[model samples]
Target chain A: MYQKSPTQEWTSNVVRYKKFSGSWAWLLHRITGLGLTAYILVHINTLASLQEGPEAFNAKMQVFMQPHWIFAAWILFGLVLYHTLNGIRIVIIDFGKGAKYHKQLLYGAVVIGLIVFLWMGYIMFFGHAEYDFLSMIVTSYN
Target chain B: MSYKYIGSRGSGSMSWFLQRISGIVLVFVMVGHFILMHYNPEMGHSFNRVFERMQNPYYQMLQIAFVVLALYHGLQGVWNIYRDFKFPSWLNMAVLAILIVVGVGFGALGIANILHF
Candidate 1:
């Protein structure tokens, strides 16, 4: 239960709230959910270029293939990965006896999410023929 | 008299169940999507590749279904979050209408893109 003094304001109340780990998970899930939903709308609009023929579509796709865009896409994948993993945890909690071990489930999700995120980053950015700079970094380090 | 929107939904058992079901389905689809689209960035990023893939009627159908299901799930999730706060019933109804309109509008756009090939 949150008590707000007359001067405290809603933002201050939230800023002062003592958040547990689960609260962070809950908040992140909501933030990512809303963001992904908005993104899907834009994604559909972007795909509408398909009707304009190959020249038009390829031009647009080429822009996205740039390194900056790839970086952005990789971040988007991270959010999607978190949402998907946590979603499974939620289902387990609701349908099975996971409530008792919910914290463990959250930990498991984070661990797995981090590993996959790194793996995906490798796939997206590292050891790339097109990304000569990235490949150069790897070789130079080796 | 406040119509008490909470009671009208009957605990939202159906939406909750549907949300779980949709989430489960999305996990599988997302795996395939990532593998197919990002495995070789060219596999999905290029117009030629996408055009070729869209030639398959079955792929087109599946993609259309993916669009519909994704929009439905996302919008429903948003509505769930919206419901957590205390808003008047009129505002709630207005938001529901806007979400439906957005889903339908973008759904049509997505389907049209997939089917264009």
Candidate 2:
């Protein structure tokens, strides 16, 4: 008879290495990938509303344009940005192109990802605000 | 634990290759989608605007390709993560079935919508 190990459970193994950057990245990648997949399903279904004509689709768009939904959209944007940047790093690493500078590549990706995230947040909030400063300057020139 | 054969051996390599290819394709399609739909939401979120864009043959083709590629890439990614966990054979089979059903169902819906437009 074969004997089972105490650490054989998936949860235990996941818990053990949860703190490492690599592990955290792996976990987040899976999570965000799953989230994106779910979003794709919802996205397609929502688009299907187009078949019903413009009114129905516009109504759905209005719902999506609500504040909470807009917040969720920003979150989705951040997730995609991170995933895409990290995915490029991963692809490069896979090709043995950046074997020596893997850690630097990851750090670079994180830095870039952070900048994009904050920039996106700024655009989402301040850029669209009533007193929109950036647009004010641009329109003033016009 | 004993294992059951789900399919032919060496399928992992095929999935890995397809994932990379799809990922490359998605980089372009998804980025275009983000710029169009999010960065310029004024036009994208409007039904008439989207309907007008969808009327273009090139845009329709892009949407179809994006739908198919994204579905394949995402489903394969889920399977890859599941494989890492080394789930029991039955559970693996179950997850595979679920991914297939969901992926195909959603992909079909997306393609149908594009065709209808």
Candidate 3:
């Protein structure tokens, strides 16, 4: 097997690292957006299953309550909170809310993102499993 | 010296405006969505109720519009971001082509689902 010399390998790694890190923020935003959208579709599909009858819907909800799904839900919530809060930051910055306070606001977003993420994580982890599905779909259903 | 902005005039600005407008609209849609899908005891966990709701023309049109704006805005944003990278033009074209196809495909399917109701 042809092998790269240590010097060549180092340079290649540095180039790759620079390319990736340069766009890391935007890349993360896009990835999380895609992930969140996919989750939304799945969520809608699951709710659509409610058409099947009470037992079938209950069974599906049970699967959703599995540990793995719970973990995935928490992660998804964190991504959403991060993306939404950061998006607000972007919009505010666009409106010139804080030119001198740009970095401060960026840092504030990070902190707030973490806080919102923790709140979501807590609800997913410890809150009662009582998210009303029908109410989410329509007021008439009530 | 005239630096022509890529989005000076065309569908780009129109799409941008549509995205923001639709995004604001989605907030209301989602509020109604959560109330009907999650809170209503009759519809909350019942699949039949959901189908019945989707059968309404107003709801279906709202869904179609939502899906269209989302795809247009999202794909355009993604494509613009990709321009920042220093890649071969061919590679860029390939990526853009795939994105366009996927966007249209998903948007079509989402609308189709609404129309099916």
Find the candidate with the highest DockQ and give its number: 1
The TM-score, computed over Cα atoms with residue i paired to residue i, of candidate 3 is: 0.62
> TM-score of the candidate numbered 1?
0.90
lDDT per residue for candidate 2 within B1-117, as digits (tens), equals: 234766324658878877877887788877778767766566777888987888899989988999999888888887787776666788877888998998888988999999997
DockQ of 2: 0.66
lDDT (Cα, tens digit) per residue for candidate 2, span A14-43: 667547666566677778888888788888
Instruction: Look at candidate 1 and tell me the lDDT of residue A113.
Output: 96
Tell me candidate 3's fraction of native contacts, as a decimal between 0 and 1.
0.10
Write out the backbone clash pairs for model 1: none
- Which runs of model 1 end up more than 4 angstroms from their true locations? A1-12, A131-142, B1-8
lDDT string, candidate 1, B1-117, tens digits: 365573246678899999899899999988999999987888887888888888899988888888998999999999999888888887887888899899989998888888777
Which candidate achieves the best lDDT against the true structure?
A: 1
Local distance difference test, each candidate: 0.87, 0.79, 0.60
Which of candidates 1 and 2 reaches a greater TM-score? 1
Q: What is the per-residue lDDT of model 1 for residues A26-119, given as tens digits with 9 covering 90 to 100?
A: 8999999999999999899888888899888889998887667888999999999999999999999999998999899999999999999999
Return the candidate ranking by DockQ, descending: 1, 2, 3
Ranking by lDDT: 1, 2, 3
**Model 3 off-target regions past 4 Å?**
A1-27, A37-62, A129-142, B1-46
Superposed by TM-score, candidate 2 places the C-alpha of residue A59 at a distance from the truth, in angstroms, of 0.7
- Against the true two-chain complex, what DockQ does each candidate achieve? 0.81, 0.66, 0.23
Deviation (Å) of A10 in candidate 3: 9.1
